[model samples]
Target: MVRQFVSSGSTFETQMGYSRAVVAGDWVFVSGTTGFDYSTMTISDDIGEQTRQAFANIAAALEQAGSRLDEVVRVTYVLPDGGLFEQCWPAMRDAFASARPAAMMIEAGLASPEMKIEIEVTALKGSAA
Candidate 1:
């Protein structure tokens, strides 16, 4: 078996001593991904938009690791405020509506003040990338 690191154009991972995602054999373990738009380096104040971006970020990382969102086996969400919990589900459902991976949502402050949602996912591939 071998190990590989996956990153999707964000500075935080290196600064935080973490990779965006890691692939070991047939498994890809993605780190908690925030809602920043990597292309613009911007995060929205809206929780719904934040949740959408988080999934987009996670999806990008999974693709880089030679996997897809549909391949995700599990997901964990970190929310700064439970108040916004209701607002996040629609976006979550749309992103993973077909996949429906086992998931959990918990309260936690994200890395930045503007970040309202963060997501981490695990995906399995049939073979190494």
Candidate 2:
């Protein structure tokens, strides 16, 4: 099987020794993505905005991996505060209303205090119709 790695141009990917997503055969596995804009390297304080940005980041990675958000088959969400999960629903629905992949949410501390949320996804290439 052929393998490919996708990057969002985030410095952390290189420093941390990981790709934003990896493609192997027909599967695309996206690493946990945060809200920090890759260009600006800045994150938002609002949970809703962060959630949207994280989806945007994930979408870009998926696109580069010959896949798309609608092809996602599984997703995992991590948040420093579980209470804020409710605030992310609107953005989540907007991003995955169609795919609605099997999902899980975990309440956990992130790499940094300012990091409010992280999301990871798995997609099958050409799975979306």
Candidate 3:
């Protein structure tokens, strides 16, 4: 199948020249997503809250790509502080309990200072075996 691009309607997408997610055949790759609420254009300082928002953003992108978090095959989280990881774990566990995708965490900087976490995911168009 031809590749399909998905958008989250965030200005950063247009500015950065990237799609929120792309679908190539049965695979869906969601771009790295920050916690800023595109609808409100705001970000939270709380790491846990940021983590939740990141997952929600990822879920939306997955849905647009004809997939869902439950179909995710991989997830990667980028955080500025390694110590903040535990705060983000429950959010991950809640979304990933069933999907249980391969996951990795990295310490990294983000686009903005208020942004606490960014998440990226890969999913299959169908359920994982």
> Whole-model lDDT, candidate 2?
0.93
TM-score for all predictions?
A: 0.92, 0.96, 0.95
What is the C-alpha lDDT profile of model 3 across 19-123, one tens digit per residue?
999999999999998888777878888998888888899999988888999999998999888899999989988989899998899999988788888899999
RMSD of each: 2.6, 0.9, 1.1
Q: lDDT of all predictions, in order shown?
A: 0.86, 0.93, 0.89
TM-score of 2: 0.96
Off by more than 4 A, model 1? 126-129
Best by lDDT: 2
Across 7-119, the per-residue lDDT of candidate 2 in tens digits comes to: 89877889999999999999999999999887787899999999999999999999888899999999999999999899999999999888989999999999998889999
Question: Model 3, 59: alpha-carbon shift in Å?
Answer: 0.7
Q: Which 10 residues in a row give candidate 2 its minimum summed lDDT? A: 33-42
Model 1 clashing residue pairs (backbone): none
lDDT of 1 at 96: 82
**Reference-based lDDT, residue 99, model 1:** 76
Ranked by lDDT, the better of candidates 1 and 3 is 3
Clashing pairs in 2: none
Task: In model 1, state the lDDT of residue 128.
Answer: 26
